[model samples]
Target: MPAASTGRRIRIRMSARAIDEPHRVASQLELLFDLTFVVAIAAVTAQFAHDSAEGHGLAGLVPFLQVFFAIWWAWMNFTWFASAYDTDDVVYRLLTMVQMGGVLVLAAGVPAAADHSDYRAVTFGYLIMRIGLVAQWLRAGADDAASRRTALRYAAGITFVQAGWVLRLVVSETGALPPSAQVPFFAALYVLELAVPRWAERTRPTNWHPHHIAERYGLFTIILLGESVLATSRGVEGVLGAAGAGSPLVVIAVSGLVLLFALWWLYFLAPAGDGLSDRRHRSYLWGYGHYGIFAALAALGAGLEVAVEQTGHDIDASPLAICYAVAIPVGVFLMLVWMVNASLLAKPVMRPAVILGCVTVILLLPLAAPQLGVAAVVAAIAASCVLLVILTIAPWTRRLQDGCPKP
Candidate 1:
């Protein structure tokens, strides 16, 4: 059954929609669907904090990236596919629900998956998600002959990779492959998975709405930003627990809030939806570039959690390590956001000199960690945020005054 409205009629059917300018917006169902992913991202970031606290350091980052990539990729696949072919009929809703089930299962496995030695539970959930995607692809292929080739290509790629996941699980369980094999296995799978969409679209590209896809990415970015806020709140709570609401704790808390809001402001300064709607050719770069953005944002949260632990003296990880944990992700987020905005607008959104300068300051933070106090380090990070806002806000303000969109 089509989802109902008391005063509004709904038309839901498995029909091949035209590729022309479709007035697209993220639907309520899409937002509801994103909630599952929000849970998944939170779990992953929490696992990162736990693993980092356990002395995993940079060693744990590889496995964290592997799992995070899988989770992000799954969400991306479903979101883009829905952008093109979402009917919102009973079948479509049911298929989406099945994907949500897989997301929940995958999220449940995140902590254990961080171990890098465990494959059973994570593989199971990944297979479930891919199987659901395969079903969706087949449905789209059958429903839309114009896009049948692209849809079937997606189905074939998903099925093949899912088989590989199952094989790895079976091999590890049977002791035919050692637990150490997951690293290489995961790398190969990531490469293969990324190539599939590019290859599929070469011949028969699906006419997904550019603005809708851009908005979906923006919304997911907001979800990750919420995780950052959650991490910041946790940091404040830890500070309050250990040192009460002292001046230092208050300063740290305020710094975290400033950094969060600055990062949010920086991201929204680019008119991503308008730009993407204009230059469809850059969609691949804009889409692929966000993997780093999403991962960096999530890791930024995990890094803050580590900072909190350090501030509370809960872990003996070096001040340098703590600062690097937070700083590196922030730098990566800044770089990728710049690159994505540049691609979208076909011009630099910020002066290269200014971007290079702020990024260098962020990158140099961990080095200053050895001499600086924890509060000073956090404050420095917040200072960099202030600089970013100062540098980027002017162009946006000028554009607005000129009645032009900020790029």
Candidate 2:
């Protein structure tokens, strides 16, 4: 029941989407699905920012990682699965909507998750999403002969890991698993969840479209970058509310936007579509590597919020710590994006020395906060990002002027 064209009418029966489908852009339904995740990511980032603002930045990392893993994993799983087998039927659309509702449920649990280490609501919401995805997999197994075993494996693996998650929640709630002990438990289940797709696709890989995959990732990247925009707007609001337009917070906000824009610019430079199309076997690593990338971008938003709050005397964190909060994520985002892009492309767009040098500069910039003030330091960090963009882009521009095509 595979469809040759992506824009075909909705089908009553389930089907596989063509692997080489031309111009196979993401559908409106998929965009709607992403909105729920925006809510979920915002909730998690806000909770983390609140913690960081209260000077609990390090201690807050645990719950942040846990909740963000659930959010990112659920989104990734559906994305790849839909790439392979989006039936676009009424039932399929409805099931996807159910996952959206689950994201809201998960979003509603962020505070309890971060403040109290309670995950009952979080687990319940994950269960809802897991149910929707599992049903999709079961249908895939029944309807698509070529990928039936793979689909069944995915369904079974997801079910097994999800049940483990529920059980972990139960034991934790019952005091059998203490808060201190929950980390290892969560780590164990997380490993299993990450392993599911690898184990499932061992024999029969799904016919996912490479260009479509790239486009989907680009859309999600924009969505994550929007967090930084929203976070910066909050900073701007605080500055205007407290010290009016002349406040130094305005500089921080402007610098933060520049830094985010540079990152977005850097991410799109790699020709991911061609690379993934040629090296499909490496898709697992390319996809898995993004965990760090996405996490860093979202964390950068929280760090930016923390930066703004610190300037306004709202957060109790040390000036240096707040500076590092911004610097560290910028460095990580730079390094991980470079690394992930290297794995995807034959030759990375940016040189290794340039990447290392920029990261080193970004990370060390925070140490000067006491002397130059946090605003100046953040502005310098943003300038470094702009420098990196220049370093990576100037060569392409020169090549184009020399009558050579830019890669």
Candidate 3:
């Protein structure tokens, strides 16, 4: 009886061990968090749509950039923190729930906040979310020295940046200075925000999980992809309902879908996660480089939404909007591809391809604008994807043949 009892205890211990370290989030949890971001993406998309529909032009672009940057920065910070110290403890779970609530609050205020004469409430809600993020970092710092150092550095940098953001909000709202003067001031502060972290990381580094970080980034990409699909669906449904023309809408939707799929394929085809996983310690560039990619992904979705709205309408869309949809994603995709290759191949063979791709796409734009409309521009985007696939696979295939490890 004593021996049997001891064996039962051992089994229970093993089961507890298994339960403690989850390699990935459960499907339900992923779905839940994803749903919250769905709300966020929808909110941002609505703001963009509203501005475009009103033909606000450059007036809308500035505020969209501001709000988009804030939202993206918040999401990026949370994802990195979770990647590092996601204990999956009950406390951690509860905190995440609070953060999610904060995201929803922030999302709800996005439109009003974008054009608000008094930006204090908007800044305050953002500040609250940042506080929650800072709390998470503080907790991590207290528990693990390495994580603590990283978290503290991150928290400090974020605090400094948020302070600047809040100050800008106050200045803008108070009418103490003209709005034009605020641009350069804000630009300088933005540069500082971008640079300070790089400096800090170089001077005082922290240990971050490579595979987990890679997966977290991949998850965010999936989130943006979800947004793209949503945008495409919204466009298709509206067109079919209004015009009752299924064929054109279907072609447009398929083009968007295919472009997204190709982007996904191109991203995974080169073994980015595995490359980063191998060199997780030296992955700061790979990690930081992804911010551009994330922005591009979100912008792509926004642009697609714009395209959908303008479809079959005689109203001429701005060159800026059309170029933005095609250009931003291509630029981001190229940069991401370059960064991944630099990380894995440990050299810069992808630069020429990126430059060539960019130049080609830019030259194609005017020709495409008059001749192609949204669908043709999308087709142009598809062509760019094809070029990228060729660029990516060519060298990778050569490397394999030369007896190099598959990157």
Best by lDDT: 2
Residues 1-407, candidate 2: write the lDDT tens digits: 33454336554555677778878889888899999999999999888888888889899988998899999999999999989888787678878988998999999999999998889889999999999999999999998888899999999999999999989988987889876788999899999999999999996999899988888888989999998789877866876788676557878888988999999999998858888998898888888888888888888999898787666665678778888889988888888888878887877899999999999998998899989888898899999999999999999999999999876
Candidates' C-alpha lDDT: 0.80, 0.88, 0.64
Model 3: per-residue lDDT, tens digit, 24-142? 44334434655676687677766765566556645666666666666666676676566545555545556667767767877777778556634565567678778878777677667
Q: With candidate 3 superimposed using the best TM-score fit, by how many Å does residue 49's alpha carbon deviate from the native?
A: 3.6
Better candidate number, 1 or 2, judged by lDDT: 2
Please name the candidate that would achieve the greatest TM-score relative to the true structure.
2
TM-score of 3: 0.80
By lDDT rank, best first, the candidates go 2, 1, 3
Candidate 2 residue-pair clash tally: 0
TM-score to native of every candidate shown: 0.92, 0.96, 0.80
RMSD of each: 2.8, 2.0, 5.9
**Model 2 spans with C-alpha error above 4 angstroms:** 1-11
Better of 2 and 3 by TM-score: 2
